[model samples]
Target: MNSLKGHPKGLYLIFATSTAERFSYYGMRAIFILFLTQALLFDKELATSIYGSYTGLVYLTPLIGGYIADKYWGIRRSIRWGAVMMGLGQFLLFLSASMLHTPGWAHGLMYGGLTLLILGNGCFKPTVSSLVGQLYTPGDKRIDSAYTIFYMGVNVGAFIAPLACGYFGETGNPDDFKWGFLLAAVVILLTIVIFETQKSKYLLSPDGKQLGVLPDARQQALSAEQAKSASAGEQSSRKWRNLGILAALALVFGTLFYLWLGNDWVSVGIFTACLVFPISILLDSSLTKIERERIFVIYIIAFFVIFFWAAYEQAGASLTLFAAEQTDRVIWGWEMPASWIQSFNPLFVVLLAYIMPAFWAFLNKRNREPSSPAKQAIGLLLLSLGYLFICFGVKDVQAGTKVNLMWLTGLYFIHTMGEIALSPIGLSMVNKLTPLRFASLMMGLWYLSMATANKFAGMLGGLYPEAGKEKILLGFRIETMYDFFMIFVIMSGIAALILFLLSKKLRQMMHGVE
Candidate 1:
């Protein structure tokens, strides 16, 4: 128990489960774009579109899964069923890769596989995260440390997946991609076995009660009423009113995003959901003023988070392209696979994970630690700096010459620091601020922000400069790699500054939680 920074045994159990689940995900993701463009003969634009839509939907479905877990399936059952779906999804991807020459079957099977993955992730992601928070009593200082340890567990898989998957799938021969997908499927099977066998023994509350049991609706409603006095009729009316507002906002946002995104339904759906869900949470009749304000903090931080992830997630698209097309990957005349570069950020996270938690704890003990939102603002700042650092590396390179690999390694290192500041802290903040009844739902909302950011990431990746192809955003041209990288610098930097200004108020809203 002391091994994971003095966390509960259940935390490590969750760590194991999440490690295997992320292995399945990041393993497949490490090679997914390559599969689309190389084996299926799709162009870069089409492949990025598919990648964006798939990743976006993967986060978006957590809303559904969260609702179910909160009301029906409960956490443990959700994990098991979700794992099965993801395992099946990976198997389908393996079949799709195996039949790459048969374009019809390959395309169909790929879509089928991606659908299961999206739905499955919806079920798996939020519940497991909520489980981590549930392992400790509320207001436990170690919650942050526990999540950091869990985050390292996640990165452990992320670190290994690319090395394994990229090696098998990114070989010059297209047919070999199936082996990577097969390995992913196998990992998901392992995920199921580990969680099912261990959950009863280890996934328990501090007082020794079995956790993740089905939620009691009447008890939840009564608890909500206790938080704020509201008659049932008034609550019903408020719920309807919120639903109506959500519908109207969705329609308006859907139209705007669809127009801006050029008829992409995926972008429209993601953006609309991101805008509406938090507002829906705010309008809940049962939330006290304090609860509502704290929830607003989650919303504010989540908005900035979109900027961070949109810039960070270039790892999958434009960055991968950069690694493949512009980075020097030779070691003694043997070229490395581009996808292996995906492991670097996660590698940095695993290396720095323990150090980060202790650093924060030291500051906390000294009464000098920043609030959650401030730390996230710092994350955005570091993200911008990371891109700005890399901008110099590519500024003067000739069209055909590649930069050294250390440039990417340097960029990933800085970005990993930013991720450490933002991602796990955000998870812990959500856990600390939210009411118990809304735990999974709020976590789902957190992932919904990622859904929007990933869609934006896809859109941004489309702006990657191609030879003789003109790309423009907000009247600015993207012609050089430096120009493209600077976009993130400016975008994230401004967001960080704005968030810094608001950090004090957001901390006030937390109302002593910190």
Candidate 2:
């Protein structure tokens, strides 16, 4: 029945589920930093630090969530639990905002809300992502298109969130923030309802079996046998070696970050795990030579992804602040809320999502489609240009001068195109490259890169030029908007060049998958 159609009905259901979940997430995120500064009464630097750590940990827990899904709960159960936790998290934020008069309870509730969010996202992100790929058979070209569709749902939520949340939360008064948080909590309930009611009927394989069921009994038995094959002494030695390696990596990275950023343990932990987990995947004894090479390709592409996200995620922090304090928002005698500016990227994403996949398809028809890594390299290049565009807009502007909103608008437009190229394509690539048994875990590892980047983004956001605060990075002093934006230009430019050079080698490593 489904053979003639381009995609299954389930894909649309996944789209709905993802859309609701993202609305909940991005809605809360739209004003979180503002909530920190205005409601919680923290400074910009501290708010960005907390913002970075919150976003970073939100991605990091996916590793644990993915592990749990693979080993115990399965994706369906994990997602349900995750949705509930996130809903509760948003509700707590509402309570926190409602109690703004009591600073201590407000602060306590905010942290508690953020904790639930982090744990819940750990469960939700990777599982939903992995599920999209599972909808297709191996070698099906539609996988990329499906993920882009799913990605559009993600952006749909992002596009609307800031408008709704910002209007309610980011009004001139701090007291209004509770309404935005409450809106997010309500949206999450929709996600639970959509998934739970529809999943049994629509979330099925081609042969009519249910998907995301518990691991096969035979597969568990096979794993048991594999464990039995390893001698106790050998297992002990391997465990110690892995621990030693992890310890050494943590020490080296922790010390370096401490020197560079001064005792930001969150960045140190996230960054250290970024390197350690990818390497640990290589340490698995079951991998064949071809599998190992393909895995390396994922690692290589993921390493470059760190730079893309670090710059791109500035939307939620530095860019939002720029919109608030430095951009001329007055249009037709109305000033837009700063948090609304965060919606631009997602708005562009929704517009461009179809165009990008079709563009790739057009290239594929002519046998001219770029390799996944090559496309990602192009994305990095576009990211660099976006920052460069903004750099020009900000150049030589006086301190206290607000530039046109068009400047930030243009940057979001270009960056959205870059994101279209990189983010969903990268998800499609990970699913293509991963072995079936390791799908969830590998997806978790992919997100681990973003965790590191987000933490780093927070550190960079702290460097946003404040009048009294002098922040120096790598011996260069940042004293203006130009200086701050240039960091992304240089960082993403170099990464693009290097990744472009390595793309051919990496494509070959994929062993004909692309």
Give TM-scores for every candidate, taking all chains together and pairing residue i with residue i: 0.96, 0.95
How many collisions between residues are there in candidate 2?
0
Candidate lDDT values, in order: 0.90, 0.90
Query: Residue-wise lDDT of candidate 1 within 1-514, one digit each (tens)?
Result: 3234477788888989999999999999999988888899887777888888898899899988998998898998998999999999999999999997789999999999999999999999999999998888888888888889899999999999999999888898999999999999999999999999998988888888788877523225656436467676877887788889999998898888888777788888888889887888787666779998899899889989999999998999889989989999998999999999999999999999988777888998999999899999999999999999999999977787899998899999999999999999999999999998899999999999999899888888888888878889899998889999999999999999999999999999999988
Cα RMSD to native, each candidate? 1.8, 2.1
Model 2 Cα lDDT, one tens digit per residue, 154-208: 9899999999999999998999999999999999999999999999888877677
Model 1, runs deviating above 4 Å = 1-5, 216-221, 224-232
TM-score of the candidate numbered 1? 0.96
Instruction: Supply the global lDDT for candidate 1.
Output: 0.90
> Which candidate has the top score in lDDT?
2
TM-score of model 2 (CA atoms): 0.95
